[model samples]
Target: MRSLQPSRDVRIASASGAITDLPENLAELAKNANVDFIIGDWMSEYNMTTRGSQKVTNTDEAAFEQQFVDSLTVALPDLAKRKIKLAVNAGASDTKRLHNKTLELVKGAGLHLTVAWIEGDEVLDIVEACKKEGQRFRNITTGQFLSDWEYEPIYAQCYLGCFGIAEALKQGADIVVCGRVADAAPTMGAAAYWHGWSRNSYAQLAHSLIAGHLIECSYYVTGGNFTGFKSLPQSSDGTGLLNLPMARVREDGTFFIEAHEIPGRGGEVSVNTCRTQLLYELQGKRYYNSDVVAILDQIKIEEGDGRNSVYVYNVGFEKPPPTTKVGLTAFGGYQAEIHYFLVGLDIEEKAALLENQLRQYLKGNFSLLKFTTSGTSTSNPVSQDAATVDLRIFAQSKSRNDLSDANFLKPCFNMVMSTYPGATFAVDARQALPKPFNEYFVTILPQSLLNHTAHIPALDKSVRVDAPTDTVPYTFEQDIELTVDPIDLFSLGPTVIAPLGYVVHARSGDKGSDCNVGFYVRNEDEYPWLKSLLSIERIKELLQNDYNGKRIERFELPNICAVHFLLKDHLDRGVASSSTYDVLGKNVAEYLRAKHVQIPKKFLDRGRI
Candidate 1:
């Protein structure tokens, strides 16, 4: 076995490709070395419900992700020979099945790696018992009680911490599998095990948590999904596919993030890339995980002297809350969508006519019907495709028969030829097929009730871990009053109206039903101007049509020259039930970037634009 490094410093790389990211991620891992641990986070909020549904039909392999096993099988021999430890939350609901399958693969490959799995993240029984005892699980987002839910939950799981994983590693396990822990829990567990840190090491834990968060999404920190991808320096290979990110964490909990220094790799690890990932999916200034609360308001990202690296520092933390978040998924009926194309002249009028016809013919069939036009009409069109606009009609109902493709398509097909001059169905019949929808409900469960345990297959033993009982009563700092220092428009010269993307970079994502958009500037001088320019009112004005008077919360991260805005209930009822065209809220930032905004001539003269 490879001996533990005496330096007490740990290097962890994420091979998490989750659903469709397996093959490429495994290839990246095989090409890199000097990594003490490999962590793969495969579960997402949406996948949990899908896995739960699968469990209902196929109990044998419902909880395990087959793609994770496939990737690990290919990498198992090398990892075993090198003694590199592995931890992953790929076992969505069933760690035992995944563990057994992995053991079979190891036996077949003639390897002796000790594997362990953690349990207690499945809390359906606990939730049901709590309900029986008159405990009404209040919805964290909607402020509604669980008793108000229309459907029965199929599965429920609580977010777990890393203590059980740490224990497994300490007991000589080479690989650890977990269920629905926090996305960053495996990384946190690996760091804690390497350095022997305790639950009370808030600062160290917080830093490690940040490190895990950065790498959890794999290539996200290495220019994947970055808005300013056009501005990032590219290598000679000329491909946008970036090397996955890895963090070299010190014993003191500070870490430098970088892509593998492989020759001809195409991405850079600059401050902008790191800062973009830091703000992704963030709810506010304070980011809460099961382990610690990271205060992102003061976090700093500095460029490193080394190529393709950035130093992350000053990540502040507070003690964790008394309870952790619990996510429950219930059947939410059915939904269906159909698409129509309106090409060339009079596209807007054609779309309006189509919606009017759809409403007249299909109004009573669906409980909720929405018509959205995708593409804008160009004033001076160069091609037919450029002038084409797609009108999408989406409907949802509790009755499966009402949402069936046969019933859903009747109205559209009936009026297709008679609708407009150049209107045609844009999608195939299969695209309009209705699918079962699931509702996501989140609440908090006391940490004490979680019976966390580490089960070692090699030793045939299981050990229970005590949850952290020390609760920290914490309140977020009051929102900073926006008093824009005011830029002298006369001295700055004329302002040019341009899309926000020309002058700034943004990253936005979903946190349940809420969406967060973080916008930042590269230079310090432009920050003050940006701060004053994009106030809550101005941001609302920019997103006026979509804002719909929803609660908008804004926070300033001056250290990073960034502002974060949270749009509550912005995604309807989150990704599972939301009828929005961009289900994951990934496009919110890009949409904002496309909005025309005023840029000062002096700032533009500096020439980063």
Candidate 2:
């Protein structure tokens, strides 16, 4: 880590995280933001299944995200005019179609721009071949063998590294479209291409990877979904919460994040905002990517010198993981859910009565039947709305006919008159129709087995991007344990029974069926207390209803004063298939925060969170 020559400064601005995210802002950002590259992330575990479903069910329609195409239609002219290169994982399941569509857009606009695409992420054939060769492809979270998987997998996609993107950018491509590349690959690729970093530049590449991960979700790093969301400032128009994020990366791979300086843009980038994004969807301290494994325990976030800016640095790294992660999706079954509102008196009894009635009246043989009650009716009359809670009935079956309105909804509808006092269902008769769901399985495959390639249409050339030659087989057990001096809760003085959010900021996200919840404190002195209070057993108790003997993994980021827990199989089969109310696990932190905890009374003196 010696002082080296300064490299070209690259400013990468993200339009959005998903295809549906602020599509209108792309043209404005491209026209105004003085950025070198503009990128967007359109793929997620849920998105993979959805996009794959489109390709499978309808071959006539373009399988890629249409919102991205519409956004590009407006932004492409500005992008070409400004020479701001664009890169996005908008291809989803069908990258080539998106690439061709992009080429068509460029041609139709009467503009000349070289568009490139990275393929080989779709590996259904490879997966089938490997399965035939005795690769069990066990589910990473549940340890279930793939042979036992009920749904037949129609699509398999491996996460690609940034090298393919870097090659495309280096080969004079003005735009690059990718399918199932690692979410952070664009930023890492842009930085690597700009800085000419070598593949063996593990530390630097690792830092770039971290930078990409931070900004990959657009505004997530710039106060969006922040625990301090109430503190977000109002835009010039007096409306609040509209924000865009950009990363200014240096040659050293260190970067500062800031909200796009567009007039009327709201939100701020602070240490906490960056810290929250850093802790999101992470499993352990060492974050494994195709390019390099980022050691995140030592990474630090600080308030930058400029307004609404946060600087990040000190990210350590090792060689890349020998295997790259892959997501295989399959049609699980048809699922239908019904909700009923129970107002006032004996809510629990009413719920029980409804469940019993439905069980007796149900005619279908369901694979999964779940009853979820959300919210607690407040005691002592305020408003009738305040005295109401929702009881949801979720039913899943392999046969769609079994979950139709007649079989599933009729039984619940049958209880309308005979059930609890003041009973009413939430949905209309038509809304109760069953819909299909997809099961997502996350596993890893040796990088050597992948045929990662980049296709440059302008040059009529296809380049093979080889997997990392110098890779280390990484395991979570190899990560060094972080040591923190424990704080004695009894010695911290009188405790108050209150919500943990009083002195803590938390964020949670899903990875396949697993969910990660990270808790962090603002003051450095409170780190030990926060760490000591949230033990694995305490977490299980807090998430008593959700835990259900699920495996949990805990890790710490001392630099950010954060503790993160991974609840395995907490969301059942992930967003697409999970019948849970909080299937995405975005509310897990808020749920945990609402749980009453014995907090140091002194901390309560800091005032309401």
Q: Which candidate gets the maximum TM-score versus the true structure?
A: 2
In candidate 2, the residue pairs with backbone N, CA or C atoms under 3 Å apart (3 or more residues apart, or in different chains) clash, namely none
lDDT of 1 by residue, 452-519 (tens): 89999798878898877777743322244463465653445688988887888899988777788999
Question: Least lDDT summed over 10 consecutive residues: which range in candidate 2?
Answer: 474-483
Stretches > 4 Å off in candidate 2:
1-6, 476-483
**Backbone collisions counted per model:** 0, 0
Prediction 2 TM-score vs. true = 0.97
Candidate 2 residue 552 C-alpha distance from true site, Å: 1.2
| Per-candidate local distance difference test | 0.81, 0.85
The TM-scores, one per candidate, come to 0.95, 0.97
lDDT per residue (tens digit) for residues 212-313 in model 2: 888888878877788898877767867664677888888878888877866776777788888889888887778889999998878888888688888899
Candidate 1 Cα errors over 4 Å, as ranges? 1-8, 363-365, 473-493
Q: Which candidate number maximizes lDDT?
A: 2
With a 3 Å backbone cut-off (N, CA, C), the pairs that clash in candidate 1 are none
